[model samples]
Target: MPSANQAQAKVQKLRDQMAQMQASTVEQIAQLKAEAQRKYEELQLQFKTEVAAREVEVTRKYDELQLQLQNIMKMFQQSQNRSS
Candidate 1:
């Protein structure tokens, strides 16, 4: 049988090992979280850029349609004046 002092020493060593393992696990989790956050920010910026490009495209199309409509209206007015 082990002496009481030896038993206490063994228990203390196990406790120290457990603490170190816990600390290492915590550090790994923190690193992973930081990496995930960085990825999320990058994705968000990319999405924003895509959305802005789409918005600009839609606006350009709308402006082109508006100009076409105005031209048609002017032509109709001129035709009506000629008939009168």
Candidate 2:
């Protein structure tokens, strides 16, 4: 039969092992959460940057169309003056 002191020592060792494993698991969970948050923030920034770039592109296209219309109007006015 195992001695009382030896059995008590074995139980204590098992308890220490369990505590260490729990601490390690908790730390890993915290690290994973932090990583996920960082990725989310980076994606948000990228989305905002893309949206800003698209707004600039649209504005430029609209300006080009406005200039084209102005040129067409001036050409018609000159033609009318020559006919007078």
For each of the candidates, the C-alpha root-mean-square deviation to the true structure, in angstroms, is: 1.3, 2.1
Model 1 per-residue lDDT tens digits across residues 8-46: 999999999999999999999999999999999999999
Where does model 1 exceed 4 Å of error?
none
Model 2 per-residue lDDT at 16: 100
lDDT of 2 by residue, 6-83 (tens): 999999999999999999999999999999999999999999999999999999999999999999999999999999
Question: Which candidate's TM-score is highest?
Answer: 1
- Model 1 residue 84 CA deviation (Å) reads 1.3
Q: Count the backbone clashes (under 3 Å) in each candidate.
A: 0, 0
Question: What's the C-alpha lDDT at position 50 in model 1?
Answer: 100
Candidate 1 lDDT (Cα, whole model)?
A: 1.00
Error of 2 at 70 (Å): 2.9
Cα-based lDDT at residue 20, candidate 2: 100
